[model samples]
Structures are given as C-alpha cells and as structure tokens.
Target: MVRMFVNGQAMSGGSIHAPLTDARFLGRAWTAPRYRFWSFRDEFPGLEPVSTDGWSVPGELYAVSYAVLRERLLPLEPPELELAVIELADGSGSLSMRVRAEALAGAVEIRHPDGWHGHLATRQPG
Candidate 1:
C-alpha cells in the first residue's frame, strides 16, 4: 500500500473526505520544518516547500492501495493539487499533495502554528 498525507478537506470530518474512509488511517503527522501554508479562499489548504525557515504543517496520513491512488484519490483531487513526495518529521517520506504555484496566488498565508485544524478553528462561528 502506498501512504499519502492529507492536509485539507479530505481529512476526518471534512468535506470530500469519504474517499479516505476505506483507507487505513495512520494517525496524525507533521511535515518537515520547511514548508509554507495557505488557505485558498477558505476552501482548502495549500502547502508548498520553501527554502526559508518554516514550521511543519500538521495533517493525517493514510495507507492507500495503488488502485485507490491512481483511480480515485488522484482523480478526485483538485487540479491545482499534485502528488509529490513529502518529508515527514520521522525522517521518512510519503506521497503528499502539494499546491502548484498558480493556485497560491492571492491566497491567505497561514503563518505561525502551521496547522489546518488551527486555521479551521479561526473560521468557526461562535
């Protein structure tokens, strides 16, 4: 099975998350401390690797089979998102979704505490 890291609406209790339900949840994980994060119109998060100092973005990991990866997950993903190898905190790598440069234009920078969950919290209505 190929493991993939999910950092946006495909996460638990999120929109468009059903595709991952049958996959094995590998619990929470973080990226290497060199990535930038953004919320694209509050619809989803987009992460990119940067050379400057950055914090690890928190997210979930899953073990998906090749059929699911090629046939379902990849196809269901937004056009702006692409599959790329991501460096994890555990000194390992997993296939992750990275945002293309075009998608991040005019996006809201998710600085400090790089986590989608934290960003989502700020958007909740009290």
Candidate 2:
C-alpha cells in the first residue's frame, strides 16, 4: 500500500493513487491556468453560454469540477487537492510520478532494496 502525506502531515489511507508510467513528464510543465472555463451552450438551449474567469468558483462547484476534469485527463482520485511530480524507489528501480490534488506539496518515502529507503520531494510550482 502507498502512504500519503500533506504539508508534512501523514494523511489517512484510501487516498487516490496514480502511477506515473507515461513519459509525458519528460518535457511537459504544470501551469495552473490563469483562467478556467466551461461552456454551457449545448447543454442549455436558448440560454447564452456562461464563462467564468479566474479561480473564484464556489467551494462545492470547484471541488466537483476539479474531480471531473482531473479524472477525465488523468488517473487522479477525488479530494487529493493539488498536483505534484514524485519519484519512488522500488527494489532495483525507481518510479517517477505526476500526481494531482493535496498529494502535491511534500516528500514521499520510497523503500529500497537491502532495507534502505529514499525520500523524494515535490517540485515547486513556478
């Protein structure tokens, strides 16, 4: 099982876990969009589409949108709260990661072979 930590505190089990297997992280960067938008033209007829700029959505709506969008694009689960890139040690090899939600801000422990261990910290956002 994987253990999760947030801001240096250990979170309980059952948090979503997504392995970073794809090589997309090789050159890509995570830039929180200055604006996030969704169109409603198709869903609501006769009503003009609505657009929201900036990160000012209500807490519930924001949470729902975060969950939907993250799941649609990646393997992230709900309530994790942010994004981070991590590297884990597994036996003779290591695994690199790009995770979402509260799992973003901290270091993770990776147990190594021969009873050794390693810790990887999340990268700072620009």
TM, every model: 0.92, 0.17
Backbone clash pairs for candidate 2 read: 80-101, 80-102, 81-101, 81-102, 82-101, 82-102
Q: Candidate 2 versus the native: TM-score? A: 0.17
Report, for every candidate in turn, its global Cα lDDT versus the true structure.
0.85, 0.21
Q: Which candidate leads in TM-score?
A: 1
What is the Å distance of residue 16 in model 2 from its true position?
5.2
Error of 1 at 39 (Å): 0.6
Candidate 2 residue 41 C-alpha distance from true site, Å: 32
lDDT tens digits, residue span 1-126, model 1: 988999888889888688888999999999988788888888888789899966788899999998988887778788878889989988899998899987877788886474887887888899
Number of colliding residue pairs in each model: 0, 6
Residue-wise lDDT of candidate 2 within 87-106, one digit each (tens)?
Answer: 21221111112233234344
Cα displacement (Å) at residue 43, model 2 = 31
Cα error of candidate 2 at position 13, Å: 16
